[model samples]
Each structure stands twice: as C-alpha cells, then as structure tokens.
Target: MENSSRDYSHINGWGIDADPKNDPTYPMKKRTNEEHRGYSWQRPTQQAETVEVLHSNERPNLTAVFGTTVPPSGLSGMLRRYAFKHTENEYAHWLPLLLADRINVVEGIIEDFKNGKVPNIFAEKGMKADLQHDRAGLIKKAVIGGLLIGGVVAFMAGKNSNKSRKLDY
Candidate 1:
C-alpha cells in the first residue's frame, strides 16, 4: 500500500505527517484528531462535527469508562446522616453513643432545674432574684403612670375651680 501521507498535500500548514488510510494506528474506523492543512479557522466543519457527535454520544457506555454497572453518585452528607439514623445497621457501633448524648443533655438540664438554680461558677444567684427584678420594673412603671394621670387631673380641677370663682362682669 502507498503511504497515505505522501498521497495527500498538507494545505496551509494544517495537515499532519501521519495518514489514517495507510497507518496501523488508524485501523480503518478509529477516531483520530490529525490536523488537515486545508481546514480553515473561519469555517471548521469536519472536526467540529466529530466533536459534536462525540459529545452527544458521551454517555452511551458508562460502564466502559467507569468499569462498573452502577455509577458512584450518591446523596450528600446531611441526607446520608438522616437516612442512616432511620435505618437499622448492624455495623454502626457509634450510633448508640450519639443517641445517648441527647439523653445526657436532658439529664443535665433536669439536674439544674430540680435544684432550683442554674449551674454556674462565678455568681450563684437564686432564680427568685430574676422574678423580683421583673416585679420591681412593673411596680416602677405603674407608679410613674399614676403620677402622670394625677398631675393632669389636678391641673384640670384647678382650672375648673378658678372658673367657678369668677363672676359674670
């Protein structure tokens, strides 16, 4: 067979030295990206069509590339954790300790509440002091409101009393 490289002219610095027809690597129908000299930058037809077909048929044989029947895609960590909690697993030894953590938190809260005091190191203040502070604020507001209403009423009564003392002149 004649060398296909010598048969065709390399146009405009585009064609490569290797030719698919006579080259062993081409093997008749295998896809190769050898550049042709005649291919114009403004209008690329053959290579572009080859690329489009390849892209369209990219997912035809997933197992061919991945070497597995099923792909490796899966849910994220949060969804996995949620699903893991609902399903019973014989291999998960840490699940029991994680569940017990919630109970321990509740027990700590109950211990603090039953003793009528919050567990604190700095200042041991009773819970009633908080209630007393709230009550004091309420009483202060009531006293201020009464003083304001009394001042308005006393001013109005004085004005009416002065009007009564005036004779028609």
Candidate 2:
C-alpha cells in the first residue's frame, strides 16, 4: 500500500524492487551502501517496518480533505455547510432566481416572435426530417435476413449429411 500522506522527496527509489512479485511490500526499499543516520526508513528496511510506517495514527479527515467527517457527509458537507450554503434560513435560496430565469426566457421568446425575429419552424424553406419511421419495413427486412441465413445453414447441414436417402415406391 502507498502512504498517501508524506512527501517521499527525501527517500530515493521509494517503492521499487528487483522482483515486485516476490516482495509484496509497499515502499520497497532498495538496498544501498549508504550509512543510516538513525533514521527508521534508512538502510535495508524490513516488510514489518514498511507496514508500520505506512500505517500511521494520523486521521484522514483531520483537515476536511480526506472525506471522514460527519453531519452532511463527505465533500457534500463542505459544499452545503461551508462553501456554497445559503446565508438565509430558507430551504432553496436560488428558487426565485431559477424561476425568474425561466420566465425571462419564455418572455424573451414571445417578444422575439412578436418582433418577427423568431421565424416559424414549420416554414416552406425550412429543413424537414423523416420522423415517420418504417418500423414494419425494418422488421420485415430483419425477418427476411434471419430466414435466409437460417435456410442456408439448414441446407448446408442436410447436404453434408452422410445418411443414404431411401426412395419409396
């Protein structure tokens, strides 16, 4: 496991090993001739030492970034309570603004139509689309293709059979 906390800039070749498959330990220490300066992580380290270092008592959400807090839960609490919360006691402070925007849009559209800015969508020069799909024709084509494929398979199977045909008088 990777210790997602500390900056490993001080440690060189932090989590590398000759054979990662053999050594299933985190921060796989590279054996170097460097003298240990009384550092726990220094010199050729053990798997137990790596495990101990990785597993720290530091709380993840001690500073509100690791998503371990209660109340509103996770980042949602940060947004709703701290960052983007309405100052007022109302449930939805943006409701009025949202409704206003919708009304303004509708009014703008109506105004444009009155001033002849918004042209008729059903105009003679307007581009038309084939909305009426031929569902029956599509189904018929699919059935025909399936039948043809099935017939070919059936014919091949019958033709390749080693059984002798008996002629009835």
Among these predictions, the greatest lDDT belongs to 1
Compute the lDDT of residue 120 as modeled in candidate 1. Answer: 67
Tens-digit lDDT string for candidate 2 (1-169): 7857777657887755656665765343454623354446444333232111111123331321222222333233233433223434454534543554555555656767989897453343232322235556656766898999999999888866634343322
Clashing pairs in 2: none
Model 2 TM-score (2 dp): 0.21
Which stretches of model 1 miss by more than 4 angstroms?
1-133
Looking at model 1, the pairs that clash are 14-36, 14-37, 15-36, 15-37
- lDDT tens per residue, model 1, 1-169: 6856453464654455356675555663463433443444553233212111111122342222222232112232233344344424433424543654555555656768898967662234343554566777656766898999999999999999888889543
Please list the C-alpha lDDT of all candidates, in the order they appear.
0.48, 0.47
Quality of model 1 by C-alpha lDDT: 0.48
> How many pairs collide in each candidate, listed in order?
4, 0
Candidate 1: residue 76 Cα off by (Å): 54
